[model samples]
Target: MTETNDTANLIQEAEYFYQKIFAAPVPRPILEKYIAANRKKMPRPDERIRNLVLKKADIEAVEMAWRFKSPRNVLTKKIHILIYLAETTPENFSLFFNTKNKRFSSFIVLAGHFVRSMGKFLKGKFLLKRYNLV
Candidate 1:
C-alpha cells in the first residue's frame, strides 16, 4: 500500500511540474500572428501549426523576459527539459517513479542521456572557469 501511494505521489509530482513548465498561456495576438505567418508559408495541419506557434511563443517569452543570463532561469530551464523528457519518453524515466521495479541500470541510462543533453550548458561554464572569467 505504501509503495502504491508512493507511485501515485511521484506521478502527481511529475504532472505538476509538466503543467508548470508547459502550461503558460501565450497571448492571443502572438498566437494569431504566428498562425498567419505559418499559413503564408504553407497550409499545414493544425497540429503542426500549433507546435510551431508554441515554439515561437516560448522563444519570444524567454527573450522578452531576458531570462537567458540568470542562473535561476538556467536551472529552471534544465528542470523543464528533464520534465519534458520524462513525460514524452516515460520508458527511460519510469524507473525512478516505479517503486517496485527500481533498477540501477535504468537510472544510469537516464542520467547519461540527461548529462549528454546538458553538455552545451555545462561546457560554457567550464570554459568560463578555465579562462578565470566566472
Candidate 2:
C-alpha cells in the first residue's frame, strides 16, 4: 500500500539522519568542556565511562548516555523540538508525547531532529560544517 511505502521511506530517512548525527564528531575540547560543566547531569555516573570520554572517545558523553543508558536513551538532542511539536502541531496533537514504545519514541525523536535540522538549513545554516558532522 502507498501508506506503508511512505512510512517505510520515512523510517529510512530517519535512520539516515540519525546516523549522520551519531557519527558526527564533536570537537574534543568542546566536548570536554561540556562534560566538565555538565558532569553532574550525566547518566551512568561511572568513573570508567567518564575517563573514556575524557580520553576522547569517538562519541561524546551525551552519545554514550544514549548507547549505554536506558530511559535516558529516549532523550535525544531534538527533544526540545518534540516538546514544541507536542504543544503546537495540530496534526501531531495528542501524539508522540510520553511514548513508552522505543520504536515510536525513536520515530518521534528523529522527526524532531528532522524538523529542527530542516529549519536550520532553511535559515542558511550549514549544519554539517557548523556541527563538524562532515
Candidate 3:
C-alpha cells in the first residue's frame, strides 16, 4: 500500500511539474530564435510521453542530452533538467530544496540554484525598472 501511495505521489508531482513548465506556449520570438538556431525542436507530445517510459530509453542519457544542448537558453535547460530529475530521481529533485541533507555537495547544488534564480529575478527587476514598468 505504501509503495502504491508513493507511486501515486510521484506521478502527481511529475504531472504538476510538467503542467507548470511545458504546458505554456513559448513566446513567438523565442520560438523563432530556437528554430533559427536549429536547436532540437521541443519534443512532440507523444515523444514526451514515450521518453518518460522507463522501459524504453535510459533517463540519465535523456537528461544529459538536454543538459548539453545549446546553452543559449540556460533557464529552459535548467527547468528541463529539473523536470527530468523530478520524474526519474525524485530524491535528487527534493534535494534542491531539502535542508536536512548535511552533505556539502548537496548544499553547493542548492546554493547554485538559488543564485541562478536570484540572478534571473534581479535581471527581470532591472528590465522592468529601465522601462519604468516597475
Candidate 2, residue 37: Cα displacement in angstroms equals 22
Q: For candidate 2, write residues 25-73 as lDDT tens digits.
A: 4333433333332333432233333332234332323343343333243
Q: Please, what is the whole-model Cα lDDT of each candidate in the order they appear?
A: 0.41, 0.38, 0.41
Point out where model 1 deviates above 4 Å. Answer: 1-69, 74-96, 120-134
For residues 1-134, what per-residue lDDT tens digits would candidate 1 score against the true structure? Answer: 35454334333333343444456343334333433433353333333212323433232233223334554443244344444454445443543466565488879987997776466455545443443322
**Better candidate number, 2 or 3, judged by lDDT:** 3
> On a 0 to 100 scale, what is the lDDT of residue 112 in model 1?
96
**Best-first order by lDDT:** 3, 1, 2
lDDT of 1 at 1: 31
Cα lDDT, model 1, residue 79: 42
Best by TM-score: 3
Candidate 2: C-alpha lDDT: 0.38
Number of backbone-clashing residue pairs for each candidate, in the order shown: 0, 0, 0
Regions of model 3 farther than 4 Å from truth: 1-44, 48-55, 70-94, 100-134
Give the lowest summed-lDDT range of ten residues in model 2: 125-134
Give every collision pair in model 3: none
Give the Cα-based TM-score of candidate 1 against the true structure.
0.24
